[model samples]
Target: MANAFERLVEKMDRATLDRMGKPVLINDVGFVAVESHLIPEMGPLTGDGISLVIFSSDYKPRRNDQTVWDGQSYIVTRYQSFNGKPQVWLE
Candidate 1:
């Protein structure tokens, strides 16, 4: 069972994605909604990758999974849960 806060988070996640997500193909199989952004710089390394936020209920990402967004390909480098959502790092 989910608590009230968790239920609220789920609602907000769905609403946010519905309003702002872009289509992304996962492993060339099907499309899922994701909020994609440029990877942020860490230390002295410049950013040259993509970060994707997607609903966990929609898709569970794994390392090395291929994704295509805006006609460009990317490989998942990392995946973790953020605020009950899935945050994916791609290169």
Candidate 2:
């Protein structure tokens, strides 16, 4: 597969923070992404990937138990809730 910084111009289903602790949405805010970086996360796996983004403000995921990226499908691996504010998992 190829890798490049693609821009997402739409609201994503789930918004969370990346390895860099940045606010990253599936397809919101139109940020730059790498195919090699996110493509792997597009599948079904039983592990967690390191954070990539550096913005953590409005991260409210739907579920959490075991986030997996199997290359073709994805699954929730953990669950985290928010309180009407922006919160990121730093440190």
Candidate 3:
């Protein structure tokens, strides 16, 4: 079972997303609402990138998974969980 803090965080995350997120397409499965952050420059090879926090219950993303956001296509290059949320990096 999740601890109280974890449950609270989940609720807060959902509320924030519901109010602020935009639609994102993942692998053409369907459109999910998420808050995405754009990084102006990622690195030499990857170039610019987008980062978004997501709940595993909503969608679990893997590396190389295709995503479409703001009318641009990208690939999931990496991800790491922080504070019960997965920070997905798209390139």
Candidate 4:
């Protein structure tokens, strides 16, 4: 059944995320432990933005929040659900 297969895929994705996710800080306050995937091909979705999809089981950063990834500071410009997970667009 398609539903059963979807559930199985979800479980597998969760397991992968649990094993690969790492803790990241937001504005030095909110902490989210998620597996972040970078989208460098978009060439700044917000005209000087960095697009990243974050898979987390607990928290997600809000819009206008700040984070430092790979030693570079970024500003969160957008937050939306992608494939049932959080996708963050930063500038």
Give the winner by TM-score.
1
Model 3 poorest 10 in a row by lDDT = 39-48
User: Candidate 1's error at 79, in angstroms?
Assistant: 1.7
Could you tell me the TM-score of candidate 2?
A: 0.23
Could you give the candidate ranking by lDDT, starting with the highest? 1, 3, 4, 2
lDDT of 1 by residue, 49-78 (tens): 677776546687889999887788889998
Give the C-alpha miss distance for residue 59 in model 1, angstroms.
2.8
List the candidates ranked by TM-score, beginning with the highest: 1, 3, 4, 2
Q: What TM-score fits each model? A: 0.70, 0.23, 0.66, 0.57
* CA-lDDT, candidates in order: 0.75, 0.31, 0.73, 0.66
Which regions of candidate 4 are displaced past 4 Å?
Answer: 1-3, 11-23, 29-48
User: Over 4 Å off in model 2, which ranges?
Assistant: 1-54, 64-72, 80-91
Q: Residues 12-37, candidate 3: write the lDDT tens digits.
A: 87787778777777888655456555
User: Which digits, one per residue and each the tens of the lDDT, describe model 2 over residues 32-52?
Assistant: 221123355588744544322
Clashing pairs in 1: none
Clashing residue pairs found in predicted model 4 = none
Tell me the alpha-carbon RMSD of every candidate: 2.9, 13.8, 3.9, 4.4
* C-alpha RMSD of candidate 3: 3.9
